[model samples]
Target: MKKLYNIALCYQGITEDKSKVSNYITYIEDFKAQIKYIINLGYRLVFPKEFYNWYKNNNFLKQDICMIRFEGGLKSIMPAIVWLIENKLFFGISIIASREKSGVPEEGYLSWDELNGILGSGFCEIISHSYNLKNFDLAKQGNNIISVPVLELPAYFDNGLNLYLKGDSVPYFDRTIVESAKAFPIIGTDINTNNLIKSSIQFITPKSFDGVLLRLWACLAYPVSTGYNAQIRVSINQEEVYSGDFNAISYPGNIQWPEMEFVTINFNKEFYFEQGKKYNIEFETLNIGNSSFRVYAINNGDNNIILKTSFLNGDNLDGLVPCIIIGDGSGSSWTLEQYSNYVNRDCEQFRGATNKYLKYKKDITQYAYPYGAYLANKDGNSISSVLTDVLSKNGFLGGFTVYPSRIYDNRESEYIIPSIAVYGNRSNDIILNNISAYIGQLFEEIDLKNIIWQGILGYDEEDFVESNKLNIIGVTKIENYKKKYKSQLLFKDIDLEEVRNQDLSVIVNGYDGININCNTNADLNYIVDLSNMFKRYRKKLELTINIKIFDTQMTNFSFINFFNILNNCFLFNFKVINNNKNNFSNSVDSLIKIVNNICTTKEKQKIMISYNTDSIFNQSNNISELSLNEAIIKAIQLGVKIQSDNIDYFYTANNISCFMNTSNGLNKLSNKIKQNGLGGISLY
Candidate 1:
């Protein structure tokens, strides 16, 4: 059984002065009794350094343990701590190193001398809560935006007409009036005609577009001798889009018989157009003298397109279309980048200050993030990298997050160790109940297959080893295996190289253990491509993946999540291994309890536990498939390091338990072993 433990945080002590008493403060009497009750419950009280040492060496305790931690330098808590020491109990104290060292002890906070005296007693472990209470000042958020150029989508719309071709030109005709209609006519060079007020051409926008409308061009020829300006109004479904005017001199043309060109009216605003939508484009001629312009167009094969003069429809001038084009010229685009120099600099400053403080004292090396602020900036942008660097550079082995989570040596990094909070006002029963619950919760999350059991067989313990144990063999370097064995196949083998040739689903359906060894990002990408290929044919895969991660892999959260998502595909029944080989063991009872509580019969077959005194990859008969408990016992019979010598320790460690951070560069984790000598009640 993996011994389950907790780190309890107490802030202040119940004092006669109501001002000093808070919800977090415990009555000195209740606190002392709670400590005694915990001890009576068989939990060994471990100091901060001891706990850290056991964790680092994988020398987990065979018995239940607890580490009580006190936060702040509040003076009222001194008596309770003294009571604990006088009774030979141990606990830890986390202090803000930046607090005034010369302050009077009675002024609510402990002075340097008082804190040192307590430490001298050899009962209290001191750690850093932070340099100061607020860690946000250590790093400011960076949220400024920087711009970069990006490609822009094309912005021209063609109205589905071959306007490049022009129709036959119309001569100067008489006053042929037409009824009120959505049409317009343009007399050839008519500057004296007061009858026609506005000339309009209707066309549809060819595609959806969004951009500034800089210029509108029309295929027309006009007499510039009159020197009068012309107006062009564009609208979509009766909604005005653009209205502008232009003079002949603006285009620099001849006074008489000016050449036909794509004359444009410049627009100062933007417009949006939808594809296949009808638009009414109207044009007007402001004749100051006897001057006019001729309208040219392509053949109107479809009657759906209309050209009109507001006064008289050009019935004589049939089968003609207007040529118009819109342009948005010399436009630029922007892409934004977020800035975080302020955050980086602040983290650097914190590192410098923290190192300077630790240079002389060297007693405190661990820090608890104030309000969990070091996880991110106020803007919620992750600054974990910066904080991690700062902590590492300052020689901190670990940091605390107060995040209320069970700490697994394999899951959380050393920098961001999670801690749970303890209540001070609870009854003895309630406190014990909470402790039991914490232990159960912690046990439930232990990964059973990863534990390492190391021991050589004892003379009397040989009965635990079964000679007929089943061994599910593992194979690697499959190319070599296939070449050496060829047609002389004796047993089934999992060949990973086949994945590159065959479909992933086909391979998975044909084999049990799917070995995916990814050494770099490229290999990970290959695995991703294989998974994508599998998705094309099936919705799910019943797979057993043994993914091997090298040093360059699994360090990233993204990489872990990728495996997590893949595990989801296997219904979360997948095995993952990294470069680190030192495996830690939990109690056998914890594993059995986990299986009994959650796993079904089918899951039992998939739960693989490896036990070998030599190499885990050894091909000798040393590999055996004893039951989970028997295997653990067999490992113990060999020379495996366990938590305790008392066999009953495994059975009772799960009972009512209790669960520190301080400085000396220490972090605490708990219970990792089993023995059969000390008899206890069989909870199993």
Candidate 2:
């Protein structure tokens, strides 16, 4: 009897994974280098199907072969797999057979065409890793039950009742074909079982609109991890609308954090909104496994935009790739604990596998057998949940509370700071002050604080500023400054430690405008250079950026470039000002939408919902107060919170327009903001 010695050592990403983004394939190059090194040790490469074929034909290993198993997905991992297939060596391959077949294909999963491409070569054969690649978790939210998705797939469509895609719906993971799994292959056995399972799709139309309805969508969830195919059918008013495969995956047990994804259906025709009309949507599921899913959430009304289309590209490979060992006669009855031995033993299969090819290498592989086999605990009693943790272990004090005292009389004014004075270079300086004074007068008539700012707005023509320069002289008591400036100016105290070359470092917030122009470019490089040269001597200098939508000069290429470069760079409480008054409410709405399109939900924190009150809200105390209703005010506040974890409402005491002058308008706005969950407000 001839003895067989074939070693297949694999390091799967899903086994020892490290990534921040759930659905992104991050360190593939690093993994490729290490895996290829092991293969060059004179061992042959084999895949799942090849292994099964060998077990059927060769019975036991008689030749030197190394098998490489990869999880299934189309374009998400095509580039790397394509490169491997083009290699001269014969290698085995595999993918998760569970993918969308009926409804619109979910983004990032393997498509049929990509799978065919993988199987196109005689050297490769794909094995079934799983059927419904999900580890289901169902929990009751009060009385209703909800389940997180099996795979960590970030979605694009944000659907809700009375909400839909407002514009032309964008398609992603488009024009891709994928293979559907017919049956599941059990591990450690040659048995294959054909399964037929069923599920459902739930769809909702947001509102009645006379315009063209762009998109219809529903979320899909898979509970079983079998490698069987699933399909879904959708209908509106009992009429079949879409019937296709569920965009499911295999071996969902490998995913660390899974997110449910929405399947998109394009409805490009106009539809009428019914005040009392009911639209019925139905979803039917067909599967070979006992796998099931839940589709919820009904949306209608206005549409929304999902930016950052590249997420659909699939460069970020997610999902799990399993590793199984065969060949030995005792491999069949391996216990659950013994599987770890297979993981450890295969890692030891490194014998003649490393020879002259290893001559160029100086480093040795660190053996940590069975690494990352344990389940991680990121939810349920995490570190963030600990409340009674120690804070002072140094033996100073415990069980005590203290705060800084504002009653301190010691004043430190020995430092020689430069004086602040305005250099009236522009003829618009005096006119600017007059406009500011009038706005202040208007605020005085209202019940709110009379304080505003001259946000440093940029211009196209040689950096035209709305106000003059800010020359700092010295520091004084906060109350003294309030007495001196009255309701004319409001400014935030900034830390000047990071400021270097600038001549003026410190300036009191005069509650007035202090606009400046950088007649230069708006590129990131330009901003860096400007910061390096003209440093502001303050920390937490949240500059209020100006937006002039209709101003042709404001649309200068440079100004637009600054914004284009930093699309998602706004803080939660980001400050922006608009001087337009003609369409005050509409202007605010549009600006909020812009912020929504540019930022991600996670990135939105501590947002500031500000109303510049320039010329738009400039009305009599009573009139401006009544212009907007309670619902509108609450909507403004809710909008900010929807896009951010934290939010606040800010209104300038004075601006180009004295809209705050409306007697109770600003006060009512403040109250409504609080009612709608705005965190804080700036008092003039």
Question: Highest TM-score, which number?
Answer: 1
Q: List TM-scores for all candidates, in order.
A: 0.35, 0.22
TM-score of 2: 0.22
Candidate with best lDDT = 1
Candidate 1 wrongly placed segments (more than 4 Å) = 6-10, 14-21, 135-362, 376-385, 425-429, 441-684
Question: Model 2: runs farther than 4 Å from truth?
Answer: 1-28, 53-64, 89-104, 129-135, 138-684
Candidate 2 residue lDDT tens string, 1-684: 111123232222221233421222324554455346445434566653343344324453444444444433334455456667777544433233334343334565665555555656654543322233322222222332233231111112222232322343322211111122111111111112223322122223344434222222122323322223445555545666556654544221132111232223333233343444555444444444443332222222312211111112111212211011001111112233333332222223221222212222222211111110111124522111111121111111111001110101121111100111111121223322322221121122222223221222222110111111100012111122223433454444333322223333444234232222222222334443434333342222232233342233334445354343233222122223433333444554564565466544433232334443222233233223212112122222211110111121223322211222132333444454343443222222
Per-residue CA lDDT of model 1 for 1-684, tens digit only, reads 333444443444445443333345666666666677667656778775555554445454557667676766677788877777887888777765445233443346776667767877778777666543331110111331111100001112222233322332310110011001112234233444444346666666565665343222222333333334545455545556656654555211123322232233444465666788876655544433344555345443655567666443233435555444444433221111111232233335445443443323435555555544354433553335545665555555666554544433334455555444444434445444444433332112322132222112332112112111111012111122222423242222233465567755656564432334222233544555555555564544323333333224546435444553454332222222211122212323344454445444544433332222111211132332222223222222221222222211121111211010000000001122112111111000
Q: How many residue pairs clash in all the candidates, one count each? A: 24, 93
Angstrom error at residue 412, model 2:
77
Model 1 CA lDDT for position 671 = 28
TM-score of 1: 0.35
